[model samples]
Target: MNPLLKKLQELTTKLDSTSETLDSFRVFHGRGKIYPGLEFVTLDYYHPVLLLTLFNQPPEHWLNENLPLLQENISQKIQTIVVQHRYAPGDPSEIVYGELPEQVFAKRGALSFHLNLAKQQNIGFFLDIEPARKWLEQQAANRRILNLFAYTCSFSVVAIAAGAEKVVNVDMSSAALNQGRANHLLNGLDKNKSQYLAENILKSWGRIKKAGPYDLVILDPPSFQKGSFDSVKDYTKLVRRLPELMPSGGLVLSCLNNPDLDDQFLLDIFNSACPQATFLFRLPAHPDFPDAESNRQLKMLVFELATG
Candidate 1:
């Protein structure tokens, strides 16, 4: 057996039917660089579908040789196998084996997020942020949350499901916000408890502020979004404004996925941009996604503003 197939087979044995039914998670994290020669690939088990993503072109015979063996050896519960080529011109996804359901969702506990498997990039939800979602599940009750760069609003869904008083989701994509609304409805969360704003957060502070004095602020912006956001240049601007949007004692869940920027990048921004806010703790990354360099993985840090 190929090393990748052997590793995947070992992982499959660890996931019982009960756990697979309850959550979507990373099956293999090659980008973490723990596994040799597989750094350009990552695989996710989205319940019934297995999505294999290639960040760079693999050897010509690699997939042809390994995919059939993988399909035969992986879990029986995985009915569909899809391959996404990030290095390709369109970053397309091909259904290599079986068929995708008309409606695909990534299930996490009691929450379900709508996924677009055919999309060029990002199939709606992020699996690596499960720890932060679990944290929100514990702390979200009765709190007003402001989710910036909310993407499909997975955080909002988790927060609302966990009994948050209210959640305002802000993103530049109207299409993403629409899916976010659908996610809330899918989870049977009350629409009245949530607000969706399809606007650039930097230019719409007044609208965002109008929705708050938020009790919790979630900052999980993309590393780079072409003309819109460049984390290195724009994160400080967002952090500096948090003090005005949140009240004393409010909490901030600031996250960065860029490997190039370490935890100190956020610590420095919060320390300098919002001096009143004290660094709390960093949330641990999900165990499945382990990086050789700890700092290169996703960073989820919590901060609390001091009482006036």
Candidate 2:
């Protein structure tokens, strides 16, 4: 068997032996650059559906040869196989095998999140951030949280489910916030306990501050969002404001996913911007998504404010 099929078979075999409810996870992380000749491909298993995403065009015979073998090997466990072409205009997903369920969700432990499998670049949930969510599950109880760049509010959902006092979710997309609201409801949590702001986070600090003084702040911004946020130039601005948002002993879960930027990029920003804060630890990257250079992967660092 080829490397791709061998990897899929190994993953599926392991998953099939697990409990009834399978946790959504990355099946193959070719984008991590750990695998030769497949750096542009990624496969994600969102329960019944397996999504194969291609960042660049593959060899002409690649799909034709592999698709049939994939179906033959894992069709029993994975009902639908969807292929997404990211290089094409308006990244589209098409079903290569089986049928799609009317509603699709990515399940993580006791949590469930709506997935936009039909369209959209990101299918509502990020599997790689499970460690951060798991961390929030343990630390969020009785504390108020401010989630910036809160796409679909996955962090908010986990926080609320873990009995957080309150959570305010801020994002530029109202549509995503709407889905976030739905996610809260989907988890059977009280949606009213959280606030959703569909506005530019940088421009709406006053409104965001109105909901604080938060006990825990989550900074999970996009690497680059045209006209809104550019990590290189804008991260310092956000880091500088951390001191004003929370009191001493307050916790901050700051995340950066820019491959070009290392952990020091954030450490220096915090040192120069919010000198009162002290570094704690960096969250480890998900094992499945292995990068040759550790610094190129997602950086989730925790910090504590030393003074009010």
Name the top lDDT candidate.
2
The stretch of ten residues in a row with the least summed lDDT in candidate 2 is 240-249
The true-versus-predicted C-alpha distance at residue 73 of model 2, in Å, is 0.5
**Residue by residue across 22-49, what tens digits does model 1's lDDT show?**
4777878899889889999998888788
Query: Which digits, one per residue and each the tens of the lDDT, describe model 2 over residues 121-200?
Result: 88999988888998999999999999999999999999999999999999999999999999999999986789999999
| Candidate 2 segments whose C-alpha is farther than 4 A from its true place | none
* Clashing residue pair totals per candidate (backbone < 3 A): 0, 0
After TM-score superposition, the amount by which residue 159's alpha carbon in candidate 1 deviates from its true location, in angstroms, is: 0.6
- Candidate 1 has what TM-score? 0.96
The positional error of residue 31 in candidate 2, measured at the CA in angstroms, is 1.3
- Return the TM-score for each candidate structure: 0.96, 0.97
